[model samples]
Target: MVRFGVIGTNWITESFIAAGRKVKDFELTAVYSRKLEKAEEFASKHKAVHTFTDIEQMAKSKEIDAAYIASPNALHAEQAKILMQHGVHVLCEKPLASNVAEVKDLIETAKQHDVLLMEAMKSTFLPNFQEVKKHLGKIGTVRRYVAQLCQYSSRYDAYRQGTILNAFNPELSNGATMDIGIYCLYPLAALFGKPKEIKASGTLLESGVDGQATITLTYEEMEAVVYYSKITSSTLPSEIQGEDATIMIDHIGHFEDVKIQYHDSTEKIISGPQDNDHRMFYEIEEFVNLIQSGKRESSINTHELALTVAEIMEKARIQFGLIYPADRLQ
Candidate 1:
């Protein structure tokens, strides 16, 4: 069994632990939070054996073989580095880090410490995504790719009422590009590699964070347009248009249903390896395998992948004037 430590006690963290419960070999050893009450609450609810308010103290101990970080975006790199330094594998949530430099630093720390470090990009670890990669050539000579993930965030309603939650706060390194746009960007880059150039613009909110964003990535043979918004929802499915066929993605982030339309007008649909009730289970399963095998990195959520995603996000933010406090960190 892989003994695990959890950081942050939010909805996403709760969801992750709920999914982890589905894995037979997964064990929630402990949990940490700045507040003792919160830590106790989460630990009790998750059946974690221990709880602590000090992250450093928990990280330095040997109670956990791995830690799942679901903290604020600005804290991800630092938390992962600290845990890895003390001999624990880390599975951090998406966007990996605030910028490329932090992602590189985290990668170096994981390598130096010989500890596993993986970004919780649930989509990449899904069997449906892997299947899509194999059949990508079916849509021969790809010339265009488009991905859009837009959902009206539950927090947005509170934000408009002047609540100003962390989801729209720049200090916490939260924005549409980092929170939602990454779902579109990472999968596209995972399939095609980094683009030659990216031209992006975002609708900056009054708080100086992006409310909506549009990015156009130019490749050698294809031009991809990515659209993401936290203020609205999109009903249109994402697609890859090629010379021979077009591949339709029901949802890039969830990767629920995928379909291919050939030139002959026949359509084929593909689903996952199995019916997984919880989407987060796939990432947890991969994490356990990597830990048991003593692997230092994930093949799917590779160090290179995190760095590329970080670089793209940083550039896009710079283009849109959405700078965060983390960008100034060393």
Candidate 2:
């Protein structure tokens, strides 16, 4: 079995563990948190063999073959670096680092240590996303792509009551663009390479972070627009338009459903219902396969793709004036 360790005790971490169990060779061997009690509790709940209040201890223990990092955005690179330096593979959550510089650092660290490092972008690994990729030719020449993932944050009510949570905290690198926009941006970058130009506009909250943003990217012969928001919700489905047909994605974040509509008024469903609750299984499976195969990076969520997404986010943040503490450090 490929023994696994998990950092962070949040719902996402739990979800990853649950989904990861479905993989044939997956095992949750360790759990890490800043507090001993929290780590113990989480380890007990997940049935992890070891609990760690210190990440370095876990990294150095040789107890885990790989680690799934779902920590706060700002801590991703630092914690990943620690694990990689000690010869542990890492499956870091999306927006791999707070900025392009950190992504570059993580890439270099993984290279130096000869360890696996892959971004845990679950969407691209899903079957529906692959189907979308496979059927892109049916849509002919792509002309426009519009993706929007605007869900009101559960912590927004608390923020409105004069309480600031990590969801809106700039110090933690939490913002609409980083949190929600990446869902739209990653798929865009994966489908198409870097754009020729970018224009960003967003509404900044009082905490000096974006609440909602619309970014337009200009390519050689096509244009793409993405809308992301944490202060509001949108009912629109993301669509990619082409000369002969268009692909409509029901939920961009989950890639649960997809359909193609042709100019002749013909329609066909390209994707079926997915196990929404266990959507993370695909990425976990990929991570384990890579580790077992002795690969350093994933072809799907590649370092180049993560860097491209990070670079785009950095530019958008610069335009929005949404500066994180890590950005100041660089």
Candidate 3:
């Protein structure tokens, strides 16, 4: 059994634990929060065996074989580093760290400690995503790709009212690309590797964080257009256009419906959830498998993929004049 210690009692953390329970040999052993009351409360709700206000205490204990980190953007590296040092496997929430330097450091730390570390990129592990990869050749030589994820954030109205939450804060390394647009970049990188050229621009809010971004990446054989926005909602689906046919991804972030339309008047649809259905289950399954295999990283969520993502995101954010303290450290 992979006994788990959860960090952060937020909704995503709950989602992780809930989904993990459905897997065989999964156990919720501990929970850590900054407040003793909060940790205790979460433990009671989740039926965890223990609760600790100190993450160091929770991670160092033998109760949990792994730690699921759902903390804020800036805290991912620091918390994961400490846990890995104690030989605890870590399944950290996406956008693994605030910058490329931190991602490199964590990768090295996991290797040195001989423990598993995986990013919780749920979409990439889904069966639908696998199906997308399998049939890419059917569309003929890829020429152009467009991947978009845009949503009207529930917190945006509050930010507009001058209440800045962590979601829109530049110092915490949170913005459209970091929080939302990354869905496009990660999948693209996983499928096609790094682009030869990148050109990016953004619409910034009063607090110097990007509300929306448009990035164009040029590969050897194709160009990809990506749009990510938290300030507005998008009705258009993402597309991979080829000479003979086109593949349409209905939702880029958590895709449910992927469609192929051929020039010969034929259509095939590989179905997925139009919305979330056990979204975190796939990543949790991957994490558990990597830990059991004594591997330090996942083949699907490769360290190389994470490194490439950090590099591309940081470069694009810099181009938009969005600088965080982590960038300076890098």
Where does candidate 1 stray beyond 4 Å? none
lDDT on C-alpha atoms for all candidate structures = 0.90, 0.93, 0.88
Against the correct fold, how does model 2 do in TM-score? Answer: 0.99
Question: Model 2, 1-330: lDDT tens per residue?
Answer: 999999999999989988998999999999999999999999998899899989999999999999999999999999999999999999998879999999999999999999999998899998999999999888989999999999999999999999999999988898899998999999999999899999999999999889999999999879999998999998899999999999999988888779999888889999976678899998998989999998998999999999999999999879878888998898
TM-score of each prediction? 0.97, 0.99, 0.97
Clashes of 3: 1
Estimate, for each residue in 1-330, the C-alpha lDDT of model 1 and write its tens digit: 999999999989988988998987999999999999999988898889899888789997789999999999989988888899999899999978888888989999988999999999898888888888989988889999999999999999999999999999998899899998999988888999999999999999998799999999999999999999999998889988999999899888877889898888999987655445688998899899988887777888888888898899999989989888888875
Q: Candidate 1 overall Cα lDDT vs. reference? A: 0.90
Candidate 2 error regions (>4 Å): none
- Model 3's lDDT to the true fold? 0.88
- Backbone clashes for every candidate come to 0, 0, 1
**Number of the top-ranking candidate, with TM-score as the measure:** 2
Where does the lowest 10-residue lDDT sum fall in candidate 1?
Answer: 270-279
Looking at model 2, report the run of 10 residues with the lowest lDDT sum. 268-277
lDDT at residue 130 of model 1 (Cα atoms)? 84
RMSD of each: 1.1, 0.8, 1.4
Highest lDDT model number: 2
Error of 3 at 206 (Å): 1.7
